[model samples]
Every structure is written in structure tokens, then in C-alpha cells.
Target: MAFADACNWINGNVNSNLTNRNSIQAICYSDVKSQFGLTANHVVRACARVAANRLTAKRKRRKVREFKPTSFDCDARTFRIIEEGYLVSLSTTEKRIKVPMRVSNYHIGKLQGRPSTSAQVCKHRDGNFYIHIQLKSDAPKLKKSKNVIGVDFGRRDIAVTSTGNSWSGKDISSIRDKYFRTRTSLQKKASQGTRSTRRRAREILKRLSGGEKRYQSWLNHNISSSIIREAIATDSIVAVEDLTGIRERTNQKPRNKTERRRSNSWAFYQLRAFLEYKGIKEGVKVIAIPPSYTSQTCQKCLHIGTRNNKSFKCENCGNNCDADYNGAKMIELWGCSVNQPRGSELLSCDINSRATESLHLPYRKCR
Candidate 1:
């Protein structure tokens, strides 16, 4: 349609009383051009407008705020085939999107603004292109209703089994010490001047991301395997205390800038994320229970009271257990509550437990 006519129609019909895109699309292209003189260029821009408006409406429906128009950088970075037809700017890639195209070659997702990074594809009715990436490496399934486990993890250890076996922290302590040294050196260097400090900080951040990726990869792979193996061996649910709020409460101070940077490398979420997918893939149930009173309440008698930072004696059962163990025990209890049926039963099970479960996820806790 002519730009003027198109604009006039759009403005007048923008309301509920006006014709929708479907109605507009129903009109013959020839008639639209003849009546409105809309050029091919106008159609191209209109296509973009349609896509953008659809995305905006969808996001709003999903309660997503802060929507914005797609930027050139966003398009180039994510979409490999944006056929804006020969562009005049350095911003556009030389690659052309034309016919005989293998749909698999299109490697872009609708969301996240990142490449799909694969060569297989699924096309939706609305022309949403999905790349076929192997999102999961399947693990052997396990029988449900097997022996379950209760675990405790803390500053000194990562996992403690109900069988009294424990996996303590040679790795965690060593990493922390390494962080301390790096942090101290960075602090000493950064204290010199602003420009140098900024430069050093950037370099430190780079190193930290690399180190964190490595550390997380190792920890996630090893720990998830060990936990899953243990669960499989016993045919039991792996019960963990929900530590979701731990990050919000931590107030630890690093000795130096290097330590601070290294601390950032610690993918705290990786451990849980791995456990989640590992459980799903293995067909084992993993549960995270309420954290409160896990440490202070006695395991034997359900006692609740604060003691030393490391140890706590339950007031009810007089159970002498590590605070971390208490936390794990509480998690186990909460897990039990979750599996039960009925809203009343779920609530009746306990107030301290709030757990979220996932299905068939591959552990991506990058070491």
C-alpha cells in the first residue's frame, strides 16, 4: 500500500474496531498496492513491524516488562540470517539469506539473543526457527521408591550421607586459599592508582571468569556423578536442604582483590543445578527442604536452639549434631512433605519445607 494510505489505514484501524493483521493479510497484495501504492520496501518494513508487534504482545501477555525494539547489534549477534537485503553500513554481515537454504543452517533462537549453535532445525507455523541441539545426554534410569538419603553440606564439607559417610572439602579449602593469595596481590597492586586499578580489575575479572568456568566444570561433573552414583547404589531419594536464600545472607569479606575475583568464580548455583538434572536423568528424586531449624533442631528429638557456629545441641532430643547436618535433615523432611498428595497434606506435612523439583535435565554446572 502507499505509505500514506498504509499509515492512514493503520492509524484508523489500530483500535479494536479496526481490521487486524490477519484481516490485512487477507487482502490481495495487488489490491493493496493498487489502492495504496505500497512498495515492496513497505512490505519488507511491514514484515518487521508485524514480527516486532507480535513479540511485544507476547511478552506483555507473559508479564515481561521493559520491552524494546530489536537493535542492529542484537540482530547481528544472534540471527545469522537477517535478510535486510544489501545494507550500506559496516554493521551488516556480508552473508546473504536466499533460496535453496537449508533450514538447519539457520541458527538463531527467538529468545535470549544468542546463537542456536547447531545445524538442525524445526520450523513452527509462525516461522519460528529452532535449532536441534542435544540439550541432554541421557543417563540410565533408576527404580523409584528405593532407599532415600539425607545429606549435609557446609563450609567444611560438600556432602554428608545418612550412612555416616561424608565428603569433606579438600577442594573447596584449596580453592579458597588460592583465591586469598590472588586477592591479596590484586589489592596490593590496585591500591597504587585509579587507572592501573581499573586495568588490573578488568584483567582480574577476565582471569576469574576463566578460572570459575574451569572450577565449576570440575566440581559439577565430579560432584554430580558421585551424588548420583551414591543415590543409585542405595536406590534412595537424595534429600538436600534448600539453600536458596544463602546467597542473600552471606556477608563474607575477601582478604584481597584477587580473592574477591576468585570468589566470583565460584558457581554456587552449579552444585544445585547439576544435582537437579542429575536426579532427573537418573530417575532419582532429589528434594530440597526447609532450611530453618535444620541446623538448630535436633535430629533425634526435633529440638530447636542456636549453639556454636559449628555445632548445635537440640533442646528437644538432645541430639548433638553439626549445624550443617541439621540443615540436611530438615531438607530431607521437607522433601518427604513435597511428594505427598493433597494441598492439605502438603501443608500439613510441614511449614518449614518449600521445595522445587525438575525433570530430566543434563547437569551444566560448568566447573
Candidate 2:
């Protein structure tokens, strides 16, 4: 009840223009404490801080109209993690409380010897309270490797590497299609069925929600693991495309219903995120480069080419190859140029001279 009142107070005061933490605290701290009857000044301040955080994060797209009472945000003065005792101490409206934590072996190992000052106490959907402790550590230095592995993300094949490795997207597409059909049918029944039938349909829909997403997340984890393992085995740095806002861009193009659904469902960003975190944890370097012309440029001739469906044909050098494989190779070349600009400058000049001579065009020095 106290937490709910605090959230209401914070929400009433927080607005789009005034989200700065210190400013909000200065304005609302005393009022929040008096209105909510919260004894701890830190608790009121924490509520204000959380409200500020939500507004500032993704500020352009998201707004914090209300704060849920399901969770409490704690700062250094309000929370402590006792690793030896396997417990978390958190401040409440009335008093401070110590709660025992049950953790997995993985979490136990990670929390060992890590100093944590802040934590969140939240209620899960399963009706249990859990404490999430934030762990901080400096990232290890990235390993230096002359070898580079390029990855091409696509719809047909999820990920294609420069080294002839590929993970097909057929299984994921099929799974998504099946789930879509099920969800559509259930939604129709939910809207236009008898009262009892509608209730059951809604229950089933609730249970089915996030099922496909979980499967996709699991598959991405495996794919990222394999890519990181291959990178480690070959002592190579991984290079991928910087595909931010790709969905929005692709959606702008003309497409049928099924094509649009497939395009929207692609989880390339999630796969990339998995690759990055796994690479960081495994001490492998992963980088993203521009995706411009990777598919249209020939890897051998470095000239614009024709891509038809799954195949690529280069008119300049008469090179014929798989489109995805060619893109991966071009990505590798681009990655090498970016990774070792000083050394690749001479190579770039040589390739440019050859290309210009073959086309009967004047060559300019690459600087």
C-alpha cells in the first residue's frame, strides 16, 4: 500500500519535460514522504529516481505515465548484498528486511567475490519475490587476430559466414508460421465465440504468448555459440553488419501479407545481440561495418554486380557464386580494410588500378 502510494505520487509529479533525477527529487522528496507516509527518505528518493530513469530511457518513443507497485528500486544506501550469507538486505517503507536468495550454480559463480551496492526487489508472475543484484566489472582486453570472419544475415539463411558455415532460417520460419496460424485462429475464436468458449480461448492464447519468442531466443543462443566457437577455433575476429532500423526500412518496400510478416518477424537484431555478449564473455572481438553494396558488389572484381534470387553474377569479372557467400566474402574484405587500414591501403590502390584499367578509366591515387 505504501509502495503504491509512492508510485502514484511519483507519477503525478513526473512529466515529459521535467525528468531529471536531482531536480525531481528536490521538488517531490518532501511531498512524497509526507503524502505516502514513507519513513525512509531514501525510499522516496528511489521512487523519484526510477521515475526519472524510465522517462529518460528511450525518451523519444516511451513515456512513463504510471509506475507499477510490483517492484522497488533501491540505491546504495538502501540495499546490500551479503554474498557470504546468500541474502539481500533491502529497505522497506516501515523498516529494513533481510531476504534469503535462491540462485543457480551459474549465478552463484558469477556473484562470487563481486561487490554490489544496488539491487531491485520485484515480484515475479509466479507470485514470488526475487532480488536482482547488479554486478559490475571491467571488460577484458579484446584479443588481437589477423584473421577475420565475416557474417551475412539474411531471410533464407539466418547467418552465412565467410568460411562456408551457414544456419538456415527454414526451421524458424516454419515455427513462426505455425504459431501465427494458431494465434490467428485463437484470436478469432476469442472475439466471436460463446462466453465459455471465449474464456477458454483467451486462456489458451495467454498460455501461448511468448512460446514462439522463447524458441527463437533459444535457437539464437545456439547459433551465436557455434559462431563464437568457430571464431575461437580459428583465432579470428567476427565482423557483422550494422543493421539498425533494418525492419523499418524493409517495411517501407512493397510486399504481400506473408512477405511482410516474414520480414517483420526476422530476429536478426536478437541474434546479433547474442553474438556480441557471447563474444565479449569469451574474449573474442566482434565488430559491425556498413552493409552498403555488400550484396551488389563482387568480392573478386569489387564492381557492381547483379543478384538474382540466391545467385550472384558479376559482369566485370564474369564471377558466378552464391549471393550470400559472395556477400560474406565482400564483408570479409571490407572488414579487413577497416581492421588494417594502413596495410590495406596499398591493396586497395592495386585493386582500384586494376579495376580502372580494365574499364578503360583514369585511375586516382587512394589516400
lDDT score at residue 26, model 1, on the 0-100 scale: 46
RMSD of each: 14.9, 4.8
Predicted candidate 2 versus true structure: per-residue lDDT over 183-244, tens digit per residue? 99999999999999999999999999999999989999998999999999999989999999
lDDT of each: 0.54, 0.82
lDDT of 1 by residue, 141-257 (tens): 645553557777665666665656666666766876776677667766666658968687767855665563576578667877887788887777787766775644552643576
Model 2 worst lDDT window (10 residues): 343-352
lDDT of 2: 0.82
Rate residue 162 of model 2 by lDDT.
94
Best by lDDT: 2
Give the Å error, residue 140, model 2.
Answer: 2.1
Question: Each model's TM-score, in the order given?
Answer: 0.49, 0.82
